[model samples]
Target chain A: MNKLAAKYLRPELVPTKACQGCAIGAIENWLLQAIDEMELKQEDVIFGAGIGCVGRQTFATWGGDNFGATHGRALAVATGLKVARPDKKILLVVGDGDAASIGASHLIHAARRNVGVTVICEDNMGYESTGGQFSPTTPAGYVTNSSPYGMAEQSFDPCDVVIAAGATFVAETTAVQWRQTVKVVKLAMQNDGFSFVHIRFPCVQNFGASALGSRDPLVSMEWIYDHTKGKTDDGAETDFAWETGIKHDASNSRPEYSKVLRDLNARVRADMAAGS
Target chain B: MALSEELVAPWAEWQESYQDGQRLLEAGTYALTEGAVAAGLGVFAGYPITPATDIAEYMSKRLPQIDGYYLQAEDELAGMHMCAGASLGGQKAMTATSGPGYTLMHDAYGWAIVNEIPVVVVDAMRVGPVSGITGAPGQGEFYVSRYCSHGGNIETIVLSPNSVQETFWLTIDAFNLAERFRTVVTILTDQVVADMFEDLFLPGDYGALSDIVVPRRHNLTMPFFPADSSEIDLPPNVIGEGTGVCVSPYTHTEEGYDIEEMEAQWSQTFRLINKIRHHKDEILRYEAVGLDDAEVIAVAYGATARTVKTAVLEARRQGVKAGFLRLISLWPFPDELFERDQPYLVCELNYDGQLVREVMRAAPDKNRVHFMGKSGEMHTVAEVCEALEGVAKHQKMPQQPYIWTEVR
Candidate 1:
């Protein structure tokens, strides 16, 4: 086992049940690297996840106290946990389906409230665990098990949603951008308000076979790389491009959701004491 | 207006101990808020809905006064989930909503139940399939509260309070039960009970009543869920305490890790179901009047029970052997309460019967069980007396205006 995995993850669940060449495991390693760099102890962080490929693969991998909420409600749970344990850090690792689809309302509201938590949306583009169903984040014109013809709907950036909802920090990275992903995650955790890190990863078995017509790990990764750069190996323009890196950074500019409540309580108690 | 009555509940002791406390006339919502505060509530997350909006308003103003957190979530789904999260993080938490908002909370309800996170939920029921009559009372959630969450192999602790004073103590009992059972306890009140103004006595010192209020305890050892065992008062697992507890929405091992074996499923189900089933004696609470010599009984719960009790006394005044049985605890069916071989007339606030089905299933004779359901209003004392007298004389409910008697 890698040193960080041994230090931060459960031993029995180390080799996650993720499919071979899935980016979920690799992204988790990057997250651990960020946490290790910050020197945060296992107990200082409360890991939470939602239901999907990211949720299944990453759930309970953390050595600290963790919870896997019902689909799309991780932020809601994290909101409560933050208020109760304001001194501790909360890290929510969920999928696109959980963060942007089923749990979209919570996501927007958590950002609006500026809840103190770091959300690592491990986006695999499609619902790979449920057999490559087309998700809201799946690029237009892409084919999946659910959308055999094409992904007819236009995909919106979750980054834009959170930024509009008043997130303190927002960043987007890909699976292959190891250094940038780790640094961005570290910065996200440092923010004392809602911070979202969207990392688009590749799914080799289902997404590759259904959309890119290849199950080869290299082929799937090269496709993501091409999309990241908007060019194929032969220098031809790809169908779409993902503008990655730090999109917004307003860390601690406003009061965090839990601290707002704490401040209110303090003021109320002070008034009561003076009156008495 | 005297009747032979037997009260079986924890409050029977509380009323005596707090006899010297200050008395006041207040709404039921105020009593619920004060009850939760006295019970050491640390967090309240709620979404405002009719018949229950006052609770959220009261909590918002009162929680900060006592240094508790009040979160007005975006919706009931987020509200209940936030309560579950707060409870898991080693604080007593609660949420309040009516039928419309309560239906949105089933997902979080099941999540809290399976994970054994202690939380108190208040569903002030109004007339509804979906937001029917917002200001009127209804007993439509009787079966809904029993089967609160979607799957089988689970049991819920549900309590109903008829008056503002009972609502105060029952709210405290709900929190205590939630702590002892390590599960969600639903206070299945209705609009009338939630909004009614009545006499309420609040204890002078919450600090002095610490013995009755179950303080939150953290489990730091392994076997976070003592699966396969029917134990009570196990300390709930706490997050952010370095316990490495894993709480999720799947069948789990005793250490709280997700497991996928038949044995694991059965063991977890056994713990969830039998913990309350085996300890029903501790959870059973009811009020009975003149059952020893009565041939017919008028049964009800929540607001309707208030009027039914009056109707029973009036029936005795007219020389009829009518009794009153009011259920305070609605779940675990209280099968022992129906062991008597007498006719029962179930009165409720919904045209379609809910509690009557349970009465039919638990009583000796399903044919002898009659339903008097009224929607959008309470059962008048006269209506209840008429049903009781008709059942006593003719073994059937007589035709009446706006009273439903069919339960098929």
Candidate 2:
């Protein structure tokens, strides 16, 4: 599924160090294309990569200026980098565990200030990062190394969280859809305020069918493609669809979105009960 | 030439200035605040605390006048994080706090260093590990301010400004150096100087304040990182994506993904350290007063250096030929300094006698540094003079020809 991206030699920029099906490969492509299409320069950017597999690799292969900070602290570092250099383009890339778990304070306030930094939570569910331990995004009723009896806590919904945090622009997409993902990321870059994009990526080594028996994200995202009502100014009421992401306004109002997460969890539980 | 802001801002400038540590710290705050703002630090996120609170007042009142943002954050930790976030967005950012507020930011500081975020922190050192003695001024947190936030072999550049002039200029320089080296630069002065009154010379032009070179907004030529090691010829950054970059605390591949190879570890560490090490000429600064033909050199910093200067002169008058080395850039250890010259004794007011040990480690021939410091009491000029005279009396080295007899 090598989709033709607009206007550039993206392969030279794409690091070959990543494995065959690493989720970030396509993500890297989308990000570069978005930067090129949107005419971005490095001086305008300072990315904070949280500690984890992705954070470490992003620092090694990413040729841009960035601060590869502590584990579970992408947003915390991003907060400092942004405040110190408010005129530069700022981004934070974190694992679901990094964002929703330890660095939660920075994540919430970064969104709360609408502090004008972009966050890309590469969600694979669970800390597939650290040998498949349960994370803030580990699905309930699913089994992981740390959740052998099934994940006790519910999963976190990033799209809803961002919308609630008063993020000016937020979207959910995956690495497979190169053009669309690039579109969302580029659009976020162009935004004058804070932007959040959570990618529903799957870790081939960890959270795949063998690990959780969950459907492939490529197939799962299919439901979103058909169910998602396109953005409309008339404020159309859309139903709560797990595949389609959040339907609420993308402004400062996270509490309402909390219900959406709760609803998503209940729906998943009901389905699990029926299957049993 | 012109009435320097460092001069006028201090109070009234003269041939030379001094503080015996019983400071009017109020004037020092004005110097630091105005110096930073004038250096293009227009954003401040802080929680109010004694000694450091006046800085917030000035930022709140002065920043709005110049289109700046002064946010009283939810708490000290959040405020510090806000300052961190704002800096990444390309604002020369700063925050001021005393011990309790500073302690809350320990882990966050490590994150900033790991991420390579350039920020200026003003710590008005007070007594205590945790609110031990918030009130009565004590230079206890000197070591905490210097070494607490180390994620690895990362360095924290600390500047101690003794007088109001140095306070203003040091803050201005802290902003410049932090932006230049891309790390946290601290103005580690005590509450005495923190609350003192003095004249300051506000620089006419923030002297290259707005000229901070951030990561260049060049198009992602390949990705942020190259796929192979050979392709890592990272060019000079030229940024245009004012809102395109994302900052994190993790070590992602150049594409901003995670890595675990020996290669990633070496590369990131190399890059992080090189940012400061490569800029050694610009990053490391110090003042050597009367070190040329001296029997003994007193190495000092911040408020203590002001006291040391007076003692150096008194020892010279007593024909002991004592000298002084004032460390403006405390971190990076200033190893090159001790290499060319020796006869050093580090003086500070701390219980653990921390920085002096660092000074000794940096020097080739380690000497037992006689300390003239106490936790609560100030490091006075008379005490330092007493120590220097004692060193001279005990030294086996020959004395200089033209003798400066003791006046009293």
Candidate 3:
């Protein structure tokens, strides 16, 4: 076993169901690495997963508490968990279909409310788990099982949506850029208010073979990085248009939902005592 | 840690501050919301739907005062999911909605049931196949609450309240049952019961709050469900409680991990049903008036029961042998209460009969079961009396099957 795997991964739960060359495995390992680097206890963190290929990452051998939410509703579940246990850090992991399609409303509203939770969207372009159907994030003219004649609508940019919806921190990276993905994920965990990290990855078995005209997954991943506009090296000013680094970072003075609730209760108690 | 004394002390004080001579008059929605607070509700999330909106509005203003959390979710689907999430985090959470919103919540309701997460859902019935009427009273959701979502071999606890006072007490009972069984408890009320104003007796004395029982975590070896019905009373380990537990909606083994084998699935399904089914005697509740010696009996619940009571009295005055059976617990279908010899006239405020179907199934003779119902309108006492008169005159009212069509 590798050194990191020996320390962090559950030995009995290895050999996952993810397809060969799928980025989900690598992305999950990177997240665990980040968690370990931060020295956060497993008991202090909870993972909420939406349904999809990426959602299966909730079973990562790290042995932390995991909640499997319904399709496109992980953010709502995370919001509730954050309110119930504000001391615990909440992280939601979802795919494109779970985030941009059925769960779009939850994503926007959670950002608008500025709830203290981090959301990680692993975009594989289409719905790979349901056999490669067209999704909201499938690029226009991309061929899929549902859209044999190519997608008719434009793909949605979730980072822009969350930033516009008042997310305190927003970042976009890809599985190929492992270091950058780790850095941003760590940053999101450290941030206070609502944080979003959109990671564009490749589905080896489905999207790679169907849309990219290639059976090899690495080829499809390289095509994605070459086409998207982002910095390939370190020490560059991150642009807002599909930039690999932090897209929007602002100091939010607005109170988080849980903190506001706590303060309000304290104030109300004080008022009652004074009146008495 | 237990809930801080300061957090719950004000609510206790508020309950005690009611004057001894003053009678509190409030809507049924207010009573239901206050009852949730009294039950130690830690989180309340919901969307605004007709007749049910008052419950959410009242909770929005009151939950914060008690150091509890309230969220106006994007929709009923999200609201139910939030309630499940909060419940899994060791909080007693609840949500309220009407028919349309209740339909949207079916998926999450199933999630809570399968995972054994305790949450309360209050469905204030309004008319519907599709947004039928905002103010119309209907019991169309009676069966839907019992067999909701798309699955087989599923069971849940459902309660019905006919008046504002009952609405308050039943809400508390719903929470208690939810905690005890580790299942989702639904409080089924209708538009008439939710909106009607009445004199509510506010109790100056408060009972000790029921303790929130969280399951002990066995580290990585924690099993969410017990091996057999013998251990069914144990609560499942919650997330973020140092359990390192994984909760899934798919058929799972005792360790809370997903399993695909049929034996694993059957074991879990059987336990889910038997947990509530075996305890039917403890869960069943109803009120019987004069059924002992009567030749004819009327079965009713929710708002329609009020009319049934008066109609039964009128039938007796006119020398008709009629009695009333008012149901409090709708699900687990109190089948034992159905007498074999007496004929039954089931009344509800829906186009097609919902509860009458259950009555017929439980009855020894389906031929003796009759239904009187109307859409978007309550059955008048006179209408019920006329039905009782027909039974007295040896007339037969055939059973009506539930059908879907536009409500006119």
Candidate of highest DockQ: 1
Top candidate, metric TM-score: 1
**Tens-digit lDDT track for model 3 on A1-276?**
555556655566664568888877777778778887888877877877888887875553556788778788888888888888888888888899888889999999998888888888889889998899888877788788888899898887899999999898899887778888888888888877898999887576777777777869767766666645543335343232355789988635577777877888788777877994
lDDT digits (tens) for residues B274-373 of candidate 3: 8888888767777777775677888899898998889988988887878888888888888988955778888887757788788888998877787777
TM-score for all models, in order of appearance: 0.99, 0.67, 0.91
What DockQ results for candidate 2?
A: 0.19
The value of fnat for model 1 is: 0.92
Highest lDDT: give the candidate number.
1
Q: Write down the lDDT of every candidate, Cα atoms only.
A: 0.93, 0.62, 0.79
Better of 1 and 3 by lDDT: 1
DockQ, Cα level, model 3: 0.64
TM-score of chain B of each: 0.99, 0.81, 0.89
Regions more than 4 Å wrong, model 1 = B1-3
Error of 2 at A11 (Å): 1.6
lDDT of 2 by residue, B1-408 (tens): 121111222112211332222223348888888877767775688889987899999887676555566766656766667677666555667888988888877776765665555678888987666676665566666667766565575656777777787777577677766665556787888877878787655544444334432321233353443333322124322223432232445454555445568777677677666666666666566777666666677877767677788888887777777878877767666778776344666676565666667666777666534444456546666666767776667742223222111111
Q: In angstroms, how far off is B188's CA in candidate 2?
A: 2.5
Q: Could you give the C-alpha RMSD of every candidate to the true structure, in order shown?
A: 1.1, 12.6, 6.5
Local error of candidate 2 at residue B363 (angstroms): 5.1
Better of 1 and 2 by lDDT: 1
* Candidate with more favorable, higher TM-score: 1 or 3: 1
